[model samples]
Target chain A: MKVRVGEIDLHVQRLSPDAERAPVVVLVHGMLYDSLASYYFTLGPAFAAAGLDVIMYDLRGHGRSSRPTTGYRLEEHIDDLVGLLDALEIDEPVHLVGNSYGGSIAFGLAAAQPERVASVVAIEAEPPVEAWSQRLGDGLARAKPWLITDEAIDLIKQAKGDHEARLSRGAGKLLQTTTIAEDVLLSRTIDPGLADIRCPVLALYGDESVLMEQVDYLKANLIGCRVVVLPEQGHSVLIERTAETSSLVLDWVREQSLVEAE
Target chain B: MSVDVQTTEAGVLEDLTGMLRVLLEEYGLEDAEITMATKFHEDLELESIDLVTLSGLLREHYGDRINFATFIADKELDEIIALTVGELVIFVVEALR
Candidate 1:
């Protein structure tokens, strides 16, 4: 469904359980060619079947959501989420499950409005620290040249096939046509120490992922946090390790709910 | 097969084909021929994201009778990727039974 949240219309899918007052679990996907489909095909249905109300939406400038040429900063994405929750009139605190860049947004919201988030499950993601911004800036800067070229797209098509080529083409358009590259760099960086987030957090990472380096920093900072590393995996843990990830998340969310009920 | 079952399956297949055509139009494949054996990923080139939209359309048409999410919940990703139109048609037909 198209939800009017502030300025843009977000494409949202809500899967409600048969039970009443089931805890809400919001699934946020990664950036650039990623959408709610990642969760919809894997974890969203599983979460719903386990009696949780699941909300999945495409972030602005991606998927079916309204894509303006500007306002692609991390804080703006956070505001969009806040507006979406408000528009839905959900008053209770909800669990946030975010992948990649989505995890950064989840941490940002938890930091900015600690009361709105009950718990967080970050899959191969980091908090939006200055270092995070710098990494993204450098990555996007490096890819911008090749991404915007037709030759590069053709090469991707030859190597990866049509679906991936289409995604690459879309990403190229998103990068070339919007302020996202610059705006995301300008996103307000949270404290590197992550002291403001009071909610319980479960961070999942692939043992082989470069982002694993942040695990120690996260453990040293957050008070109530747990980090799990999946063996023989990389950045694609969410898609590649769907079953295990789903089980771990369901267990984590259920445990948090038990704690809340206490 | 009973005459009644054949007729019912035919009706379900026709309806599902219409729904798929509507979805395929967005990808500029509106005029493409669809059949029971047409593979969603290989033949039509429909991405997993397109299935999300199809799920919504299924709910709108069949209400709660067809639980598209639950239907594919147990299937592995590879299985889902290899699904054919006939498989979905049978699932919908059985679901409405």
Candidate 2:
């Protein structure tokens, strides 16, 4: 269903367990992807089976959320998430799970307003703006062939090891129409900002992934941080190692005991 | 939990530098270029994100006992800017020890 979050209209899917509870877990998707499509491919029922209510949604300009001509800022993304929860009237703080760019947004929200988050789990996401831009620039310079393609995208999904569903034409449309902001990529570094976080964080990365190869630096900067590496995988650890990733995440969520009803 | 500045440990810097160089080499950078002075952002053009990503590698080889937060705030950005191979070696050795 759609809910109004500030000026944007967000598309969300709330999967409640057979029983209702408190502190629902919200699954926020990354750039050019929708929550239902992406989260289902990686982690969904794992949390549900653990007795937590799951809420998934597309951020503005991705999936089913409202797409503004501008305002694709990371802050906008965070606001959208906040607005979604507020609109849904879920009173308790949420256990947020973010993937890729969504992970960065989750950190942004937690850093800016700690009271709103019960905990956070960030997957192979880039840190923040200055760092992200520098990395992108370096990647453009050192890495060959900068263009993103359908096949490359497919390969990325495969590398993540998706079994939920192959990328449909509709999914491509969902990705293509959304706009990503460069300003958002220039503003925050997750490490420097992480000091403000009081919640527990489980930061996961693929052992062989070049994008998040700097695990030690992240661990160094984040307070109360835990790291997990999936061997023989890359940036797409969620897909490449779905069962293991799901198991680890579900176990973490179970321990947190965050479930809610609207 | 913070970076120590008063130590004069021998070969510590070189050893740390050697380990970093090996990791950098995996990314196709030259051993000569991956020095301690290699500023993760400027000289190497490593984005802050790269620094975040790179930290994982250190944890993998070094183990989790190392304090990541202390290591970051201890040094000057300029010192880490285009870190020299020698400087990086010293930084890691001291931080790890």
Candidate 3:
């Protein structure tokens, strides 16, 4: 469904239609080449089957949502998420699950409004830190070729066959026409620190993932946090290990709920 | 992928076929040519997102009455990618019945 949040239309998908009063678990997705489809295809139905009402949304300028030429910063994303929750009338403390960039948003929100978040599960995401500014800059430099180069854009447009042609055009619009590539390179200062996040947190990263140092930083900084390393998995662990990752999330949420009730 | 035809709904197949045609049109397939035997990935060349959309549409129209995800639930990613249109139709048919 199209959720209007601060002049932007966000695409929100619920796992079940009759989701009133169920344990709410909201999912946030990664930036660039990631959408609500990642969770919608893999973990969402699993969560719904486990009796949790799952919510996943496309970030600004991604998926079926409207691509505003700006607002790619973390603060805007936090506002977009909080506003969407308000629009949906979800007042209870809900579990927040995020992958890669989505994990960063989850971290920002939990730090900003710890009370609103029951627990946070970061899948291959790092908490917002001052040092991340440089990291994001370096990452953006590496990504510029595939994202902004005219040759890459031409190659994306040259998708063969009629079926792929449609996907190629849509992808080109997301990458070339929108300001996502440029907007994402600049991240606003995250107001709250990881020390400010008081909620229960579980961080997951592949043992082989390049972001191991970030995971170590998460363990050292965030209060009441536990980190897990998936064996033989990497940054794309969500796709490479869907069943195991979903199982981990399902079990984590259950344990967290039990502790909260007690 | 193995398609279980035991749950096929003879009554609803025609209406379901028509719906499939309209839905599959976005994938460059003609609605008139979509049949019970049409493959989702091979014939229609539908991507994972497309299957997700199809499932969402099925759930929207039929609600919880027809659990379409169960058809692809047990399958691995590759198996889901290989599923045919007939498999999906039968799953919906069985759920409705």
Worst 10 residues of 1 chain B by lDDT: B1-10
DockQ versus reference, model 2: 0.01
lDDT of 2: 0.61
DockQ (Cα-based) per candidate? 0.54, 0.01, 0.28
Residue pairs clashing, model 3: none
Give me candidate 3's TM-score against the actual structure.
0.82
- Fraction of native contacts under 8 Å reproduced by each candidate: 0.48, 0.00, 0.17
Evaluated on the second chain alone, the candidates' TM-scores are 0.88, 0.52, 0.73
Clashes of 3: 0
lDDT of 1 by residue, A1-262 (tens): 9999887999999999888999999999998878898898889998998999999999999888999999999999999999999999987999999999999999999999988899999999999999999999888877777887889888998997766787887888888888888887899989888888889999999999999897898899987589999999999888889999999999999999999999
Between prediction 1 and prediction 2, the one with superior DockQ is 1
List where candidate 1 sits over 4 angstroms from the true fold.
Answer: A154-159, B1-7
Q: Is candidate 1 or candidate 2 better by TM-score?
A: 1
**Which lDDT tens digits does candidate 2 get at residues A1-262?**
6788888787665657788663488886666433444564346545665677888777776554667766766777777788888898876778888887788788778887788888788888755546665665454333223224556556755674332123333334443444343445445454554576777788889888875555786677775588888878887766556677778878777676633221
Q: Rank the candidates by TM-score, best first.
A: 1, 3, 2
What is the Cα-based lDDT of residue A11 in candidate 1? 97
Chain A vs native chain A, TM-score per candidate: 0.97, 0.79, 0.87
